[model samples]
Target: MIHLTLIIVDFLTGLLAAGAWALASAGGAIAAVVGSGILGVSLFRRWRRRD
Candidate 1:
Protein backbone atom coordinates (compact mmCIF):
# COMPACT_ATOMS: atom_id res chain seq x y z
CA MET A 1 0.00 0.00 0.00
CA ILE A 2 2.83 2.41 0.78
CA HIS A 3 4.55 1.71 -2.53
CA LEU A 4 1.32 2.26 -4.39
CA THR A 5 0.84 5.64 -2.74
CA LEU A 6 4.43 6.63 -3.58
CA ILE A 7 3.96 5.74 -7.22
CA ILE A 8 0.76 7.75 -7.37
CA VAL A 9 2.48 10.75 -5.89
CA ASP A 10 5.34 10.50 -8.35
CA PHE A 11 2.96 10.29 -11.28
CA LEU A 12 1.02 13.34 -10.12
CA THR A 13 4.20 15.34 -9.71
CA GLY A 14 5.36 14.38 -13.18
CA LEU A 15 2.05 15.44 -14.66
CA LEU A 16 2.22 18.84 -13.01
CA ALA A 17 5.80 19.35 -14.15
CA ALA A 18 4.82 18.57 -17.71
CA GLY A 19 2.01 21.11 -17.55
CA ALA A 20 4.37 23.78 -16.28
CA TRP A 21 6.88 23.08 -19.00
CA ALA A 22 4.19 23.34 -21.67
CA LEU A 23 2.96 26.67 -20.31
CA ALA A 24 6.46 28.06 -20.27
CA SER A 25 7.01 26.94 -23.83
CA ALA A 26 3.81 28.71 -24.92
CA GLY A 27 4.88 31.91 -23.20
CA GLY A 28 8.25 31.80 -24.89
CA ALA A 29 6.57 31.39 -28.24
CA ILE A 30 4.42 34.45 -27.63
CA ALA A 31 7.46 36.50 -26.67
CA ALA A 32 9.27 35.40 -29.78
CA VAL A 33 6.34 36.40 -31.96
CA VAL A 34 6.17 39.85 -30.41
CA GLY A 35 9.92 40.34 -30.70
CA SER A 36 9.91 39.36 -34.34
CA GLY A 37 7.05 41.73 -35.11
CA ILE A 38 9.02 44.62 -33.66
CA LEU A 39 12.16 43.60 -35.50
CA GLY A 40 10.27 43.35 -38.77
CA VAL A 41 8.81 46.84 -38.43
CA SER A 42 12.16 48.31 -37.60
CA LEU A 43 13.87 46.69 -40.56
CA PHE A 44 11.13 47.79 -42.92
CA ARG A 45 11.37 51.36 -41.79
CA ARG A 46 15.14 51.33 -42.12
CA TRP A 47 14.96 50.24 -45.74
CA ARG A 48 12.05 52.45 -46.64
CA ARG A 49 12.76 55.60 -48.65
CA ARG A 50 12.25 58.66 -46.47
CA ASP A 51 10.45 61.68 -47.83
Candidate 2:
Protein backbone atom coordinates (compact mmCIF):
# COMPACT_ATOMS: atom_id res chain seq x y z
CA MET A 1 0.00 0.00 0.00
CA ILE A 2 2.78 2.42 0.91
CA HIS A 3 4.65 1.54 -2.27
CA LEU A 4 1.64 2.32 -4.35
CA THR A 5 1.27 5.72 -2.70
CA LEU A 6 4.94 6.48 -3.31
CA ILE A 7 4.63 5.52 -6.94
CA ILE A 8 1.67 7.80 -7.38
CA VAL A 9 3.52 10.70 -5.73
CA ASP A 10 6.51 10.17 -7.96
CA PHE A 11 4.36 10.18 -11.04
CA LEU A 12 2.65 13.39 -9.98
CA THR A 13 5.97 15.11 -9.35
CA GLY A 14 7.26 14.12 -12.75
CA LEU A 15 4.08 15.38 -14.42
CA LEU A 16 4.37 18.75 -12.68
CA ALA A 17 8.02 19.06 -13.66
CA ALA A 18 7.16 18.40 -17.27
CA GLY A 19 4.47 21.07 -17.19
CA ALA A 20 6.89 23.62 -15.73
CA TRP A 21 9.45 22.87 -18.42
CA ALA A 22 6.88 23.29 -21.16
CA LEU A 23 5.78 26.67 -19.75
CA ALA A 24 9.38 27.87 -19.59
CA SER A 25 10.01 26.83 -23.15
CA ALA A 26 6.92 28.64 -24.37
CA GLY A 27 7.89 31.81 -22.50
CA GLY A 28 11.37 31.73 -23.99
CA ALA A 29 9.96 31.35 -27.47
CA ILE A 30 7.66 34.34 -26.98
CA ALA A 31 10.53 36.47 -25.65
CA ALA A 32 12.72 35.56 -28.60
CA VAL A 33 10.02 36.49 -31.11
CA VAL A 34 9.34 39.84 -29.45
CA GLY A 35 13.05 40.63 -29.20
CA SER A 36 13.58 39.81 -32.85
CA GLY A 37 10.67 42.04 -33.85
CA ILE A 38 12.05 44.97 -31.87
CA LEU A 39 15.50 44.49 -33.38
CA GLY A 40 14.09 44.38 -36.87
CA VAL A 41 12.12 47.57 -36.39
CA SER A 42 15.13 49.44 -35.01
CA LEU A 43 17.30 48.36 -37.93
CA PHE A 44 14.66 49.35 -40.40
CA ARG A 45 14.32 52.83 -38.92
CA ARG A 46 18.06 53.33 -38.89
CA TRP A 47 18.38 52.32 -42.52
CA ARG A 48 15.48 54.51 -43.56
CA ARG A 49 16.97 57.56 -41.80
CA ARG A 50 20.28 57.05 -43.57
CA ASP A 51 18.57 57.48 -46.95
Candidate 3:
Protein backbone atom coordinates (compact mmCIF):
# COMPACT_ATOMS: atom_id res chain seq x y z
CA MET A 1 0.00 0.00 0.00
CA ILE A 2 2.77 2.41 0.87
CA HIS A 3 4.54 1.68 -2.40
CA LEU A 4 1.40 2.34 -4.39
CA THR A 5 0.87 5.61 -2.56
CA LEU A 6 4.44 6.70 -3.29
CA ILE A 7 4.03 5.97 -6.95
CA ILE A 8 0.84 7.92 -7.16
CA VAL A 9 2.40 10.87 -5.38
CA ASP A 10 5.33 10.88 -7.75
CA PHE A 11 3.07 10.70 -10.78
CA LEU A 12 0.93 13.56 -9.54
CA THR A 13 3.98 15.65 -8.77
CA GLY A 14 5.35 15.15 -12.25
CA LEU A 15 2.07 16.05 -13.85
CA LEU A 16 1.78 19.19 -11.77
CA ALA A 17 5.30 20.25 -12.75
CA ALA A 18 4.58 19.72 -16.42
CA GLY A 19 1.32 21.64 -16.21
CA ALA A 20 3.07 24.58 -14.54
CA TRP A 21 5.69 24.75 -17.26
CA ALA A 22 3.08 24.62 -20.01
CA LEU A 23 1.04 27.34 -18.37
CA ALA A 24 4.07 29.62 -18.08
CA SER A 25 5.02 29.07 -21.70
CA ALA A 26 1.48 29.67 -22.89
CA GLY A 27 1.27 32.89 -20.93
CA GLY A 28 4.55 34.13 -22.38
CA ALA A 29 3.43 33.32 -25.90
CA ILE A 30 0.16 35.14 -25.44
CA ALA A 31 1.94 38.21 -24.09
CA ALA A 32 4.32 38.24 -27.04
CA VAL A 33 1.48 38.01 -29.56
CA VAL A 34 -0.41 40.83 -27.91
CA GLY A 35 2.68 43.01 -27.77
CA SER A 36 3.41 42.40 -31.43
CA GLY A 37 -0.14 43.23 -32.44
CA ILE A 38 -0.01 46.50 -30.56
CA LEU A 39 3.31 47.39 -32.11
CA GLY A 40 2.11 46.54 -35.61
CA VAL A 41 -0.98 48.68 -35.30
CA SER A 42 0.97 51.64 -34.03
CA LEU A 43 3.50 51.37 -36.81
CA PHE A 44 0.77 51.13 -39.43
CA ARG A 45 -0.85 54.29 -38.16
CA ARG A 46 2.45 56.15 -38.08
CA TRP A 47 3.26 55.12 -41.65
CA ARG A 48 -0.19 56.04 -42.88
CA ARG A 49 0.11 59.52 -41.44
CA ARG A 50 3.54 60.00 -43.01
CA ASP A 51 2.19 58.94 -46.38
Q: TM-scores across all candidates? A: 0.78, 0.93, 0.86
Per-residue alpha-carbon lDDT of candidate 2 for residues 1-51, written as tens digits (9 for 90 to 100): 999999999999999999999999999999999999999999999999999
For each candidate, the alpha-carbon lDDT, in order, equals 0.97, 1.00, 1.00
RMSD over all Cα atoms, model 1: 1.7
* Clashing residue pair totals per candidate (backbone < 3 A): 0, 0, 0
Ranking according to TM-score, highest score first: 2, 3, 1
Those runs of model 3 whose alpha carbons end farther than 4 Å from true positions after fitting are: none
Q: How accurate is candidate 2 locally (lDDT)?
A: 1.00
- What TM-score, to 2 decimals, does candidate 1 have? 0.78
| Model 1 C-alpha lDDT per residue in residues 1-51, reported as the tens digit of each score | 999999999999999999999999999999999999999999889889564
Find the number of clashing residue pairs for candidate 2. Answer: 0
Error of 1 at 1 (Å): 1.1
Off by over 4 Å in 1: 49-51
